[model samples]
Target: MTSFAELVRYLAERFLQAGIESAALDARLLAAYAAGFSPEETVTKRDAALPPEVLDRAVEAARRRFAGEPVSRIVGAREFWGMPFGLSADTLDPRPDTEVLVEATLAWCRKHDLAGAPLRILDLGTGTGCILAGLLSELPNASGVGVDRSEGALRTARQNFARIGLDSRAFFLCGDWGDALADATFDIITCNPPYIETGDIAGLCPEVRDFDPLLALDGGKDGLKAYRDIVPQASRLLRVSGLLIFETGHRQARLVRDMLTELDAGFQTEIFPDLAGIERAVAGVRQSGGDGGRGKKKVGNPIGSG
Candidate 1:
């Protein structure tokens, strides 16, 4: 019988040769997953005898890793904002950078005295429903609507809501931005839309560049296409004094800020830094007394439109 220690070493070396950056960690995580143990537990039992089935599953997972599948997809879930979310290819795997948008949104909600109120929220392009689900998990009194263009993605989000026991507090809509949500007015709106420039997609890591959905990536020529559509629509969805929060590429903060300004949306906008200290989130506040200029004029379906 092969020992866990020996299997770890074999998988780690194979992953490294496959060019996975976190080869060792990935090996341990997959091994632990197959053994029904936590990664921490795997460390303590490295010399334990591995069951044949467990060993085979671990090796198969490693082979998938070697082929460049994202570990999140391999394991079928990811942790975001301290919660585990089920994932699928139909959904964009939740990312740590997006947590920056969550933190900023929470801070803004606190500052505006909306933290504990039963405020409505809209999550545009809500892949895996992570943003909306995470926020609802934190704010018990909040309810939300999650919109996505992909039916598969919406199904995944619905599954996540039920898994997290948030189904009663959340609604899933299948349509492009603002179309399925025309009558909704929210106190908080959030999104992490596709912002990678079309040309830059080819240059991303194979894990992301190859495996992730192109509909969740290609941000058009300059990567600001989603911003243009989302900004105006978000403005309309928010109640007066409501907040609009979004995650953008680090270098596109100023450009997004400028776009929000052009909307004349009565928003007081500011940029928030991510863990890397790069400006990764931009938030705008609908002014207390100003009109949102009749909301977004229905533009031809931006995302989730087939």
Candidate 2:
């Protein structure tokens, strides 16, 4: 009988030969999932015989992964902010870089001593509801609305909210940016909008270009379409002292900041780098010359941030 350890090594070799990154990690994850055991448990049973049913499922999963499907999508979930969030094809996969936005928001809250405050949050293009879910997980008393233009994505986000036990505190809305929110004012607004340039879509890795929904990836002409829509709406949706946090394309930080700067000088904007030293998050606070909100001009995060 093939041992579980042998099976994982076999799958890892297949994945590596197929040019998939993180081959070992993916192999172990798929193996553990197919065996109906936690990854930790799988590691413990590595020397044991692999059940035929387990190997069967693992083989199928390997085929899909080899075809360029993201392991997260294949597994039907992705962990964000240390929590397992369900996924749907219509929604963008939750990513680590986007966590910078959550970290920024949380730091701003803590810096301003709003940790225990009851706050209202608005998330635009909230694919999988990861942004809202991540923030709500940290800011206990806060509740939010995750707005997405796609009905399928909206439903997925709603399901994610419920799955993470934040259903009662979070709701999903179908609309473009603030259209569905009307005059609703929030203390904080978060978004990880589509920022990939239209011309650049076809050049993306197959996992993103083929599997990720176009509505969640294609930003018009120069990749600033969603920014144009979201930035202006933030001015209206946010309360006087509200904060707007965004996850921008690695190279689009300056442009995003410039766009916001041109829209309203009332906002104090800051660009923050991800762990890789790439500027990945931008934060803006509406200021009316009087500490409208967390007025510090430092990078998005400063207090136990990241």
Candidate 3:
């Protein structure tokens, strides 16, 4: 191609023919990634001819994309909470909907005037460590430990935190849920666990079904396995009045809330919608104990009616 625009359009047409819905945007992003340039730079230089090496890179990326590999997988990164996170074969790519968990936690902290205090945070099923890293970026005084069952996921998570200069404030551990946490309690605990049921896994989109790790997607028979595995531990892992924020699968908010409530009577739950008006997240506050009654505060939903 003689120009970046031409390259992008060519790639877009290929992707379109391949039945990719976000063809144009994906093409542009892939071209920029392959060319070792920012998407903005690619846009600005759209009319310029690509270097032979860059064209080769773009061609290879297109081939992979055509083969059903996600652009994030081909590019080895995905942006979450406006920051780049490295990806691993075993880690779930960060999804925009998961950001609801971060937003909710931040709002909870702000409402309780806990944002400025030295706080410990925990992230179960950390995946790309997106939730923990995103929270640390906003809560300056917060230090977090991200626990994942996959060592590969942990490695990529560490890379992401270090890439964004949050490594000093972030710790990664390999374990299933809160098993590694012991008696340690935190000001906020977050998770975006695998909530897609095993039977439903086959129906996921190509990117999720083929590119995302099964370990990060399969939630058991009813998609409630992770909830069952996490709720009881989370109840113990949170300090009295601490917050537990997590993302759930479609239509999972209410059931997940019930699971938490049944697991611990101390927690008071609130469900919030994502930007798309879907109830995608639930946050529970540990009530009772020394200064642990924030659940009784009238802090309304932080992410109000979407």
Candidate 4:
């Protein structure tokens, strides 16, 4: 029988040889999962021999990882905003970088004293509902509706909302952007739309290019297609003083900011960076009735950039 520690080391070596970046961490996670051990238990029982079945499962998981499967996919769940969210083939994997959108939204909510308000949120392209889940979890008085085009993605989002105990506070819709919603219905609209340029999809890391749904990856020729679609819809869906926030691709922040500004939507735009200092999220607050919803400006804030 292979001991848990031995299996972890073996898997780590193979993953390292395969050039997997998080080799050691992935190996341990796979081994722990196979053994049905919690992370803490995995540490405490590292020396214990894994049962034959457990060892077999761990090896199989290792093979899948070697084939470029993400550890989160292998485990069927991922942690985002300190919460575990389920995933599906149709849903884009919830990533830490995308958390920038959530952080910035939260910061804005705090600064505006809306955290405790019964805020209504609409999350576009809400794969796995991670963004909506994160916001709803943090803002206790907030409720949300998540919209996605994929039925499978919507199913996963529904499951995720239930898993996180926010089902009662959340709803899912199958539609194109805000096509299925009423005008000025939400106080906040968030999106992490498909932003990878169509031509650039082939160049993405295999973990993404291979596994994530194509509908959630292809952002058309300029990689700003989704933004173009969502922004116009957001202008109508968001209430006065409402906020529209989005996670942008590499160096795409300025373009996204420009889109919000150029539109006659009375938006006040801001750019925020992620931990790696890449401008990852852009937020725009819709101004009230003045200027007939045409006032626009660009600004910057440091609330959750890091």
What does the lDDT read for residue 104 in candidate 1?
77
- The TM-score between candidate 2 and the true structure equals 0.92
Of 1 and 3, the candidate ranking higher by TM-score: 3
Q: Local distance difference test, per candidate?
A: 0.82, 0.84, 0.84, 0.86
Candidate 2 has its poorest 10 consecutive residues by lDDT at: 296-305
TM for every model, in the order presented, reads 0.90, 0.92, 0.92, 0.94
Q: 281 in model 3: Cα distance from truth in Å?
A: 0.7
**TM-score, model 1 to reference:** 0.90
Score residue 88 of candidate 4 by CA lDDT: 95
Q: Which has the better lDDT: candidate 3, or candidate 4? A: 4
- For lDDT, candidate 1 versus 4, the one ahead is 4
Between which residue pairs do clashes occur in model 3?
Answer: none
Please tell me which predicted candidate would have the highest TM-score against the true structure.
4
- Residues 1-306 of candidate 3: C-alpha lDDT, one tens digit per residue: 468888889999999998999999899999888777776788678788888898899999999988889988999988899999888898998888888888888777777788888999999888888889889999899899999999989888888888899999988899989988787888888888888989998998888999899999999999989888888787678887788887888899999877766653356779988889999998887766333333445445532232
Q: Write the per-residue lDDT of candidate 2 for residues 243-281, one digit (tens) a residue.
A: 888888859999887776565536777888898999998
lDDT digits (tens) for residues 1-306 of candidate 1: 887878878888988887778988888788777788776778788889988999889978887887788888899999998878888787888889889878777776676566799989999999899999889988889999998989999999999889889999999888887777777799888888899999899999888887788999988999999988888786568887787888899599999977765665656678888888899988777765334323444322111112
lDDT of 2: 0.84
Task: Give the clash total for candidate 2.
Answer: 1
